[model samples]
Structures are given as C-alpha cells and as structure tokens.
Target chain A: MKPLPRIVSVLSAALIIAAAIGFLDAAYLAAKYFTGGPIACSVLDGCDTVTKSAYAVPAGIPVAVLGVMFYASVLVLALVFRERRSVTIARLLAIAGAIGFLASVWLVSVQVFILDALCLYCILSAGSSTAIFILGIAVWRLAVARANASDAAGHDSTAGRLPAVGNK
Target chain B: MSKSSIAILGVVVLAAAGLVYLGIAADGGPAAGGQAAIMTAEDHVKGNREAMVVLVEYSDFQCPACAAYYPLVKKIAEDYANDVAIVYRHFPLQQHRQAVAAAQAAEAAANQGRFWEMHDMLFEHQGEWSGNANAAELFAGYAAAIGLDGDQYRRDVEASAGRDRAQEDFQSGRAAGVNATPTFFLNGQRIVGPQSYSEFAALLDEAIAQNR
Candidate 1:
C-alpha cells in the first residue's frame, strides 16, 4: 500500500484540530446563551455585552448554535477524508470551510464595526474557522498539483485514490 | 459508514455534551461574582438582608436592556422583599457613553444612602439622558430630587469615592463573570432565559425552597 501524501495528512489534521476548537468555543457560547448568564472571558471582557446584545440571538437562534453546527460539520468531513482518503469528502470539506470562512468574516465585522466590542471567545472561534478555511485552500491546491503531475506522467496519483473496500 | 467513523462521531458528540456540562457546573467558576455573592458592608442591599435568596444584579444605568428589566426587577424586589435580598452592582458598558457616569452618580447617591432611589430614577429616566451630553448634570439633578443633601451629593459625585465605588462593583461583577447589564444571579447562580415576571418569581421560589 502506498503511503498517503504528506500534504493530505497534514492538512486534514490541521482542519480537524481547528474544527474541534471551533466546536468547543461555539458550544461554550451556546451553553452560556441558554443559561442567560454571564459569559466567561479570560482574556477580553466584552463577550457579555456582545452576547447580551440583540445580535446574539437572531430570529430565535443563538449565533453560537450556528457556530457549533458549522464546526461540527467541518470536524466530520475532515475525519472522513482522513480515514478514507476520499476525494468527495475533501471537496466537501473545502466547501464547508469556504462557507465557514464567509460566516467568520461577517461575525468579525459585526464585532469590530457594529458592536464596537471584542470578545476573546468569539475571536477564538473566528481564528479557528479561518484556520480551517486556510487549510481547505491548501488541500485544494494540492489536488490541482496532483492532477497536473498525473497528466504529465501518465500515471494516476494514488494520493487522490479512494481507500479500498474491506480494508477498513 | 465504517465502524471507526461511528466511533469517532460518538466521541465528538460526547465531548460536546461534556463541555455543556462544564458550563453549567462552572467547574472552574465561582468567578469573582460567585465568590463575592456574599454581601458586604459596602454593598447596596434592597431587601431582607437576612433573606436566604440573594439576587445580585450587575447593571448599567444607560443600557436599554437594563432599563427594560428594571420594572421586572423592581416588581421582584417588592414581591420577594421578605424572601429575597436584591443587591445592585455596577457593570457599565463601554459602548454606552453615559453608563459609567450614571453608575458613578448612583454610587454617589449610595454614599448618601439613596442608591436605590438613584438607581430607579436613572432607569425611569433612561430615555432622557441615555445619549444626552448633559447626562452627568441630569444625574446630579436627580440626586437632588431624590433628597440627597446638595453639598454632600455634589461632593460624593465629584469625589474619587463615587468613581471608586462604581469601579469596585464593575471589577467585582467582571470577576463574577458578568459582561452585560441587568445580569441577575438568583442566589449566586445566574438566572438564565426567563423574560417574564412570573419566570423570575418561579426561580426565586425554587431558591426559597432550596433554602428551607
């Protein structure tokens, strides 16, 4: 069996870590929102203001819940790609990462320009999602590179192949 | 899905649940708010200090949410006056320009033993001075209206004691893990998600029962 590409493993691992971190951050915020209590801020103190603001809950759902869902999806997709080396899962990871990235941009904008306060936990969440997005782009570039190399050499890239059935 | 995939997902789900549990337990908490839940000689108390249920509120005078909850809190203070002790603390936000000043003014009133009067007055008239440039002056007038001695009120409002008092509460509230205004802790545990008057009373009842 061929060793999986170093790039694939590295990027997948990075995505998984970032997504897990994002999941924790989002989940913590969601819990605090549900409790309707004060938010814990070890670094920055503006989270309570942000969370208590009207913007915290939109159309009845706390924004933190959305974050939890998004990060959870990323974690799952990254896991599938890591295990099966499935190109479909990788592509989906990239897509989810793009979506999360866009969401992060909007959230950061809300904090800096609109809310005028910074929350340490919120910033952690934003950083985690941004990292996943960057790793997704890296995975995408690797795929393109593999495709080009395969075209020149007339040999299929094993790195992009799906894991064989019954091998699990 | 492969067996390993199922296993991985199960772990993620469990971890998520554990995090939530930690939040409720506040395993590392009793933040300054929780630790300081015990009343002090300097605290502004509005009910039976001997009551078993102590409801501490971290609030800002200019915050709309705090103002909105003012009546609900006022009602709670009255309904549970004998069963609950309501403690007011300052938590002025940076966004609201007049919040800190209002808090300081309330503290000045506190020096004259008129904290609650100033607190209620500020909330009732929040609309008048929320964004007004003359908020401090308006607060001084309120102080006078609330029957605080003019000379003492002015001295208290202008002196470092007022600012220090407000800052003290602000820091304590922050230590207690409060970020927003009108954050109420019924018996030192935060009151989460109940917006109506009944909902608050229900929690207080639970606390009262627990005490007995």
Candidate 2:
C-alpha cells in the first residue's frame, strides 16, 4: 500500500488532535451541567457562570452535548477517511469544521457580552474547533490540488502519481 | 508557503477578527439611546426597603442556574437583611417551556401578597415541574402550598396582568442589556450568573461603603 502524503498525514493528525480536545472539553462541561457541580476555572474563573447561563443550553439541549456530538462526528469522519483521498470526505470535514467554528463564534460572543463571564474550558473548546476548521480548509485545498494534479497527468499515469501529488 | 496558502491564512485571520468584533458587538449590555427604568413600588421587594443597596435580579424560574443560585441568593438576602434590598423581576426566556408559566404563577401569587412564598417554593421544587408536561398543575399546587387562594390564583395565572408584568420585566431586562439569567443589577451595574455569596457580599459591601 502507498504511504500517505506528508501534508495529508499532518493535516489528519492535527484534525484528530483538535477534535479530541474539543470532545474532552465538551464532555467535562456536559458532566458538570448534568451533575449540578461547579466548573473549576483556573484562567478566567467564570466557567460555572457561563456554563450555567441561559445561553449555555439551546432548545433545552446542553450546548456541551452538542459540542461533544460535533467533535465525535468529526473524529469519526477523519478516521474513516484517513486512508482515502476522497474529496467528498474533505468537503464534509470542511462543513463540519465551519459549523463548529460558527458555533464557537456565537458562544464566545455570548460569554463576552451577555454572560459577562469567560469560561476557560469553553475558550479551549473554541480554540480546538478553530484549529480543526483551519486544518479542514487546508486539507480541502490539498485535495483540490491533488485532483488537479491527477487530471493533468491523465488516467494512464494518475494511479502511479497519486501518492506523490500532495507530498511537496 | 504557496500564494494560495498565504491567501487562505489571510482569510482565516480576517474571519477570526470579524467574529471577535461581532462577539463584542453582541455583548448584551443596555441597548443604545435609553436607560432601563428603575424598580418601583409595583415591583416585588424582599428585605429592608430602607436599605442603602438595591440588588435587582432578573430571573427565569425554570432556569437550572437560577435554581442553583436560589439558596445562595436567599442566604445573601438573609445575611444582609437590613443593609440591602432585593427586588425580583420575571424575565422568562422563550427557550424554557415552563418558564413563562412559572413566572405567571409567581405573578398570580403576587396579587395575594405571597409572591416571595411562591418564588421560594418554585425555585425549591424547580426540578419537579420544570420539565413536567403538567407544569401548570404543578405550579397551581405550589400556589396552594404557599397559602394563596386557589380560585384567585388560577384566575390570575390566566390573567393578562401576570403575563404583562412578566413582559414588562423582560423588556426592561433587554433594554438594560440582559441576555441571560439570573442577571443581577447591583445598584444598576450588571452581574450575571450564579456568583459565590462572598463575592456578592463583597459587592454589596462596596456599594454600602460607596454610599457612605
């Protein structure tokens, strides 16, 4: 089997790591929300306030649960498509990342303005989502580049050149 | 990096900056052009009316955070009985299915001069009725438990007066930049969420000292 391109491997690694961070951050918040315990805030000292705020839950569902689901989905997709250079998978990653990014934007805004409190865990989760989104965009670009390179090489030589397309 | 990579980085930076700006703009502080109205005699009051410090809370009864802060806030009121005045306002969020109903129940109780009793009962038993399909029935039970006239309570719950009162509080909250509960205005400065009693006491102390 051909080895993965350096760029794809790096991007996949970053995405997985970022998604894992997001999942853990969200999981902690979900646990705190359900168990009725205070969230320990080291940096900003408002995790409890922000997490317990009205905006913390949307549509009666915990935002942390939603965050967990989002990160878990992204993690699964990244692993499932690890071996293949599927453009569809790349697009899916981009879409998921974009959604997470936008959500981070809204949540951060709520923390800054409405809640008047900053949650360290929330900020960490937002950072992870932002990282995943940036990586997702890079991966998509890489996929597009590979596709273009393959088309230029044509069908006969494309298979042989596939592994080398995105390495440089 | 390639030119395309540079371009992507530029776009990312711009997007991040834009989002940060939006977040700052969205910060729900008092709206532009008008100051929120001050609490009046019509508002429900707890503790000493002659207190130098006034802490007005805009709360949704069904909010879990509000329930969590209930004991802490009640304790504060007790501790600063003579030094601070606590005012309760209804700001039922649209999200909580039972919030408005609970607010109305408290309003209904207000008519019978038992608002604080109902408020305490609702927050204490919040988990029991917050998600129940028969929340209205549960609230009615609470009204009766708090010594309100049953028939009068039921009628007031359905009355526009209760709803209108809640709406007025919500509008004032919005006008004052309240985006979440349980939001507290300590002498007109906003403090959001469940804060420690010590923190609250400190703020209260500061207000008292400032007044001196």
Candidate 1 CAPRI category: incorrect
The TM-score obtained by model 1 is: 0.64
TM-scores of the models, in the order given: 0.64, 0.60
TM-score of chain A of each: 0.82, 0.86
lDDT of 2 by residue, B1-212 (tens): 34543453355335444644543444344323123336588889899887778888878887666777789889998998988889998878765667788889999999999999999999899768866789999898888888889999988999999889999988887887766677778777775333488877888888889986
TM-score of chain A of 1: 0.82
The DockQ figures for the candidates are 0.21, 0.08
Write the residue-wise lDDT of candidate 2 on A6-88 in tens digits.
Answer: 87878976887787667766766665567553322221224366787779888999998898789878876665445455767
Quality of candidate 2 docking, DockQ: 0.08
Off by over 4 Å in 2: A1-156, A160-168, B21-37, B192-194
- Number of the top-ranking candidate, with lDDT as the measure: 1
Model 2 scores a C-alpha lDDT of: 0.74
Writing each residue's lDDT as its tens digit, candidate 1 over A19-66 gives 888998898888877876533222233446677677878888888999
